[model samples]
Target: MSYLDTSDPQRPATAASDTNTAVTSHAPSDHIEMSEVVKKQSNGHGSVNVEEAQAQFHALARRLTRQSTQHNDKSGGDIEKQETFDLLEYLRTTSGKQDEAGFAKKHVGVTFENLRVTGVGGVKICERLMKCHDEFFLSPYYLAKSLVGGPSAAPKAILHSFNGAVHPGEMVLVLGRPGAGCSSFLKTITNQRGSFLSVDGDVRYAGFDAQEFGKRYAGQAAYNMEDDIHYPLLSVAQTLQFALKLKSPGRLLPEQTRAELNDEVLSTLLSMLNIAHTRNTVVGNEFVRGVSGGERKRVSIAEMMVSDIIMNNLLAANTCHQASRAVVCSWDNSTRGLDASTALDYAKSLRIMTDIFKLTTFVSLYQAGEGIYDQFDKVLLIDEGRQVYFGPAKEARAYMLSLGFRNMPRQTTADYLTGCTDPNERAFADGRSAADVPSTPDQLAQAFQQSKYWSRLVAERQTMQAEWQGEGDDPSGTKGQFLQANKEEKRKHVSRKDPHTVSFFGMVKTLVWRQWLLQIQDTVSHLRNVLKPSLIISL
Candidate 1:
């Protein structure tokens, strides 16, 4: 018989701190059983003090202990097996029950036509020399060169004419070689265009134009960078708690307060990612020793998801019928630090979230296995900033094959699609020569323009644009509904037109609280820094 020991669900175990280490005597897929018990115990105790909550929790734990002991005695031999709790499963089952406001029901999709991104490249030494007209010796020569034909920085096209749509409940895998603009494409779609020199395209989120989406529902779109960044001194729990606090929505679920809801969501996130045990551990960097890189990556993901949920609370406040999708996320090689199995698991987890939340997601991966590749609904292949292909994920291989590209033995579908970007790496099909197929990036781009995939994308975009135009009365579109609901959820002081549920002062207070929490968490580190100047002077 197996038992899940949730003796202290609030405080995660610190016994196994290593990210790579598996939970002892528990299968990875095993579901924890404390959610029901916790719900029952806390039913009427929502406003209970910390001490009272702890007392009730301990009582529940003891009851579970007695039950396990009784089962062990009946089975004889005094042996028992414990199962690791599955937080994602608990959330999945309890999601509908807790937030009848349709937190998981809202959906958001993204569509872009003729999407192009351009950026200025770094200056070379030669270009720098051309700017040395005021320098000591070569003033005359540099001046002459500057007057004649000085090197000037030109905008390099990072992404050109990329057209695609990712609807609610669908995940698209962006397959491309390094520097193929996969990252740029993601950044552009998420409206992170500040770094780029120019971005020209028609981008809409749930029928809301870029300006409207940015002003009203920007928080609903998130971009998860490849690198993980965190405060090295703060524990995973502290970091996530601060994020939840700052991003806390104006309204609360049924009978729960803001604090209570944050706690519940935080616990669920920690458990969902199976990092509850490492909640107390610091998210260390190169200077400190703490959570492993994989765990840190998971923390980053968990933090992003926390932000997503806050948006959900605002978006799903009303209009459950129109809120099928509300979040659009772009993940840029988010599985970079994980093992193959963990990477696949991460994709599967995203797939689950995409389905359950009705989210529109875009993920870019340089190295993805077949399992991970199959998790996505669509595939967009890029080469040298040009979109070579965009269509269904399963059809990608066949499309590449139709383009006279050969799939090598044991090559994954993701690999095969990415290999199409490299001339030396990709092989030609039988009886196909370089002349018979599209070879260069331009050729591939041109070929894609001629393919049925391009036609389908164009047709889809036209239909969507027509529908959006027909929604002239409701200019904000589907996401506009989310924004309107969010407005209603705002405080009396907050303007109905204001996008944020929290006021300016509220954000400042949350930030100050975070700083205090950080100082308390790492007093030793703070003391060392504070005393370092004095120590140096004494030395």
Candidate 2:
């Protein structure tokens, strides 16, 4: 519903003019005179209800036009076609300038041809081709449509066509409920095939197809799913080393180079996610001694960052220049805001890095946190597979208030979003005044039950209990069975003779014989030496 009208720049102006003409023509003389006075005063003082005036004018014109004509079908269709063509042209032109040489190369010899044939011939040829290689011709969009039952079931619908181009570095938020197909939309953009749609829209990166976009831009865009950290059975240094090996390219680096890369990755990750203290700690199962929950999250993020860095470095080395752009998407469930020192340091470091690398980052926030809006250019609000709002974060509160929802006094964008999902409970949590509170306990209970907080907690507990019981029962049984088997095996083993006393007597007798042999050898050698000396003196 909240669509960007990027098409037809003259449409609004034409509508406004016609509406103004109709309104002025129909207004009473006294009312017209008063309107003139107000307009003149407003203009003089630089104050005007321009938007309302334009709307009123357009509405009046539309009413008059509806009464005057049945329909101009042919003209309307022609105008629409022209508009589409013009919009497409604008897209091509804008996209062309961004990467002129690339665009030229891609479109150089591409052409659409219409093959003429008598009905059945063309149909038969298409059928044969379809049967021959369906996989080759099938696209993600077509697959999604088939799975979802129809094109209408597909998540994306053109709300408003735009004439101007959407520039790079511009953030577009696609907000929707859990099952509203937002994830599908994203998947579509990534060219991931499945039963559901993730992202459904035309996306070009630097004048390349979606596949090419993935190759060129995917490395820059990091999509962090909401999953607990996976700690490998290794030390901190070993873990990073293995990660580097997996993510980094080429033969293993020299020891010094490896160490430097590791240190750099570790430091950047620590600064980015604000978890420097846990740099040396192991990240494994908590029951077996591992990092804290927050630290684990940071470690996972660090792994991702290291991957991106390696990707960028590889690309830079190949291209003979530095990679200058990056994007990251993180899904977090933590409601607590970052520490002040960490937040400040991150902001400063992010600015410096962005400047150094010319990075354009897009982070999607699904958790409750403060200052996230201030860091991004735009915020998109989606509810139930529809765009509720899309614009500046500062305007969000007013927009919600206009929708008959009360804004929390100290709530962040995430909190407000959560509240939107469950207004009554959020209101209660905020502790509304006595007069403003719901009248009955039933109402409050219903609100609380509907809150995401309660639902997520229940889900998490159920998962934990299931995992614990399943793992605990099997391990306990295995230990008991092993112990029983060991006892039985020991009892069945034959008893050995007591040989210690016999071995001790044998060792004493061997030692006495060796001492007697040594004394006789020493005396014989001394007598031989004395005989040799006496013979030499007689000669």
Task: Give the TM-score of each candidate.
Answer: 0.73, 0.41
Writing each residue's lDDT as its tens digit, candidate 2 over 243-354 gives: 5543432222222253454555555445445455555655666554666654565555456555444323221111111111233333332212334322322332332222
lDDT of 2: 0.36
Q: Worst ten-residue run, lDDT, model 2?
A: 107-116
Model 2 ranges off by over 4 Å: 1-200, 215-220, 246-259, 271-277, 308-320, 323-356, 402-407, 421-539
User: What are the candidates' C-alpha RMSDs?
Assistant: 13.2, 33.9
Q: For candidate 1, lDDT tens digit of each residue in 1-539? A: 11111121221112221232121111112222222122112222111122232232233323223333323345433222222322235445655653554433344567898888889987666445444445667778768977898577777889888888767778889988889899998888888888999989889976788878777666667899999888898899888987787666564433347676577667666655667788899999989888989889989988988765443422222322222123778999998888775676577667655654567889999888766776778889999999988988767777777777665646777777788778879998778767877888988888888877888998877776777667665624554445554554564476765656567788788889888877786898778888998899999
Scored against the true structure, residue 489 in model 2 reaches a CA lDDT of 18
Poorest 10 consecutive residues of model 1 by lDDT? 21-30
Please report how far candidate 1 places residue 400 from its true position, in Å: 0.7
Residue 42 lDDT (model 2): 26
